[model samples]
Target: MLLLWILLILYAIFLAPGSGRDEIFHALIRGDFADVEPLVVTIFSFLGVFPLLFAAILLPDRRSGSWPFVLLSMGTGAFSLLPYFYLRGRFKGLEKIVTPVWLMRVASSRSFIGIIVALFILSLLPLTGGISLNAYKDAFMHSSLVSVMTVDFLILVPLSWYAMKRFRGIPSPISFIPIIGPALLLWQQRGEKDNERTE
Candidate 1:
């Protein structure tokens, strides 16, 4: 779960500057990027993917220790993977075959439902007021939003697919975590050691 939470934090960071939040602030409130830059947007935009991909790499499977934690992490991370999934389904031939399956899995998961609820709640934040939805609409037109969203889609789709593959009995050597595929390899190694010890 910690791993998954980390991803959510990153997602929030990356989504902030490019998403409706920053756009509305810039347009309506005339908030300057310089003011928000140091604390939030810019740094997050660059490094936000680390925690999520990190957690996903570090996180163990559901059967290992606490299943709920694993589920929660996967769910949250899955939400973070939304952009990736969208793009993969569009560009990758492999995803074209897998998209329906992925979609079905998403529809069945409680985590996906939670994301919807959370986004709804986030919009209600006092600072967000009521115009956030409008801002979100505007965010689509911005170049930053498109760039970030595209990158997000590419990274997340494979991660989600790998997770699904892991669940469905296909053992994958690849981990969804960015800049750290080795973590999954290490986990696999550890899993083998544990199994050998039991044997």
Candidate 2:
């Protein structure tokens, strides 16, 4: 994971190609989606969901001081997060800091997870009309923001699966479903815990 993170940084800095990144970035920041492709917007929105999913699964552990990286990932995506995973793998004795009860309650709540799942679905709705692969391909080749974000999304998918297994033990088969999968696993885990309490 460390090597992968290094490679990703190197690629983004020196190898990724494209122009007008500033314009697209500023447009996105300003909520001017009029000129952006639906696919690009969808992928950008998914970046938000990825971090929330990670927080839901990782933050409650207390041993994992990964909240900082997860918070930064809301803007930088995998660039900010890969290091946390790397350290998590290298260190087993991470200091057990106290996670706030309210934060844990919010992170593990069914209502919160349901809202996140709804956002995930909303993010996908933009692409329901079918996007042209060729256009996206061209943008990816020529737009650095699009290319880097696309790669970031891909990296987060397997990382999510890995985090699930490491933190939650054997992940549900449905957890393999990409963005929403890990979230579903979290929801399922929360349900089990609730059931245990009730019983």
Candidate 3:
């Protein structure tokens, strides 16, 4: 994890300034970047996906008030990933933490995973939609919201995915089937490790 932190800090120092939280905030609240893109408002809405899905994955074995951190992550970006790392030591490992009754109810629902999956598809639709996809390609090259969402998507989702894999003790390497894998893990009532513990 030391190498991960080093790379994180270095990347933030060098690359984040160009497409950091402040830019996302300004573009979101005031339409600061309206003239530059296919659509800034649409981008702003989709931007929240990184945090929302991330929170859903992390909340199962964690305490209450995780929602606020998820809300904050929209502008704070990587700041959200910090708190959970601190909590990992406290609970002896996230997998073994005490899951709340309410959280279990939420996690056990297959429909919830379906919803998250649908939203994910909807979220990326703008970027992946034909002409817009080509436009996003240009923006990605020049570094617009493409860069911001790309960085946030890269950072948060994989972190959540790794945590899920470790928590579930999934040795399958490809534990998740790409888009819905994390959602499935999040929605799991009793994961592989959970089942082992129960037995």
Best by lDDT: 2
How far is 145's C-alpha from truth in model 3 (Å)?
A: 5.1
lDDT of 1 by residue, 59-133 (tens): 333222222222343434344343333343354543223323344444334344344334423423434322344
> How much does candidate 3 score in TM-score?
0.58
**Cα miss at 199, model 1 (Å)?**
15
| Clash count of each predicted structure | 3, 0, 0
Rank candidates, lDDT, best first.
2, 3, 1
Write the residue-wise lDDT of candidate 3 on 1-199 in tens digits: 4455556666655664344344444554564544445443345454555565555555554553354455577676555665655456565545554556776556445555677777767655544433456655565555544565556556665666676666545444443344456665555644554577789
- Candidate 2 achieves a global lDDT of 0.80
RMSD of 2: 1.9
Backbone collision tally, model 2:
0
Clashing pairs in 1: 7-52, 83-153, 84-153
Worst 10 residues of 1 by lDDT: 61-70
| Candidate that would win on TM-score | 2
Candidate 2 Cα misplacement greater than 4 A, ranges: 20-22
Q: Is candidate 1 or candidate 3 better by lDDT?
A: 3
